[model samples]
Target: MKIAELGADGTEQAYDAMRQLRPHLTSAGFVRLVNEVQRPQGYRLVASWDALSGRVVAAAGFRVQHMLAHGPVLQVDDLSTIPAARGQGHASRLLAWLEREARFLGCAQLHLTAGTHRYDAHRLYLRHGFAIRSFQLSRQL
Candidate 1:
């Protein structure tokens, strides 16, 4: 397995990977979002690929920004391990890599949100040393 920063050439693969986990995000939307992130700006997308199979097994991304209270922070936006690739430590590897990258970027903290119903993911996050910082309230626009 190899972990790499996704470039423009990997947009289609990344979109397919995200769509496999999140079908609600349309292909066009995923492509557009990816293109926007690929710009020389604040966001980054990382992918874990199985070199032998040429398959993307896991992915995670983060947006770097400054917060008044937190100084520099990294907002972890998406973290997904392909259903068939779970239990293979792909998610953990991706997360560890992300953490290292965040540290390299001089981020003081990392934040993310998960649905309340995603208990398994919650457990994984806890195991990875993430605490429940606060509840997120959202009203559909």
Candidate 2:
């Protein structure tokens, strides 16, 4: 498997893998969100592709930014692997790739949030050296 960032030319191809994590997003919306709304804000997309199938098995969306509390941080907004491709190291490869990106960008920290019910993902995060620092609470308007 190969892990790499998906440039504008490759953004559209990330939809399928990403949709596994964000099922509510339409392909067009994902593209627009990445290229228009998010890209302008420093967000980038990366994916893990299976060399044999030449198919994207896992995808991650992240950005490098400075938060008052964390200083320089690489925040991952989405991480997903197609259901059929889970437990095969695709997610781990993507996480490792993201960590390389974080260091290359001079980030002091890496951040991401998993839902309370995401037990498997929580394990993955812990294995990758992430700690559960705080609870995230959200209120929909």
How does model 2 fare in lDDT?
Answer: 0.91
Q: Can you write out model 2's per-residue Cα lDDT over 10-127, one digit (the tens) per residue? A: 9888999999888899999989888999998999999899878999888999998898998999999999998988999999988899888889989999999898988999999999
10 residues in a row with least lDDT, candidate 1: 34-43
**Candidate 1, number of clashes:** 0
Residue-level lDDT of model 1, residues 1-141, one tens digit each, is 788888766766666557755789887778777777544576677888876688887777678879898998888877887787777887788888888878998999988878788788899999999999788899998
The estimated TM-scores of all candidates read 0.89, 0.96
**What TM-score should be assigned to candidate 2?**
0.96
For candidate 1, list the clashing residue pairs, or say none: none
Candidate 2, residue 9: the lDDT equals 77
Provide the clash count, candidate 2.
Answer: 0
Tell me how many clashing residue pairs each candidate has: 0, 0
The model with the greatest TM-score is: 2
Which lDDT value does model 2 have at 131? 98
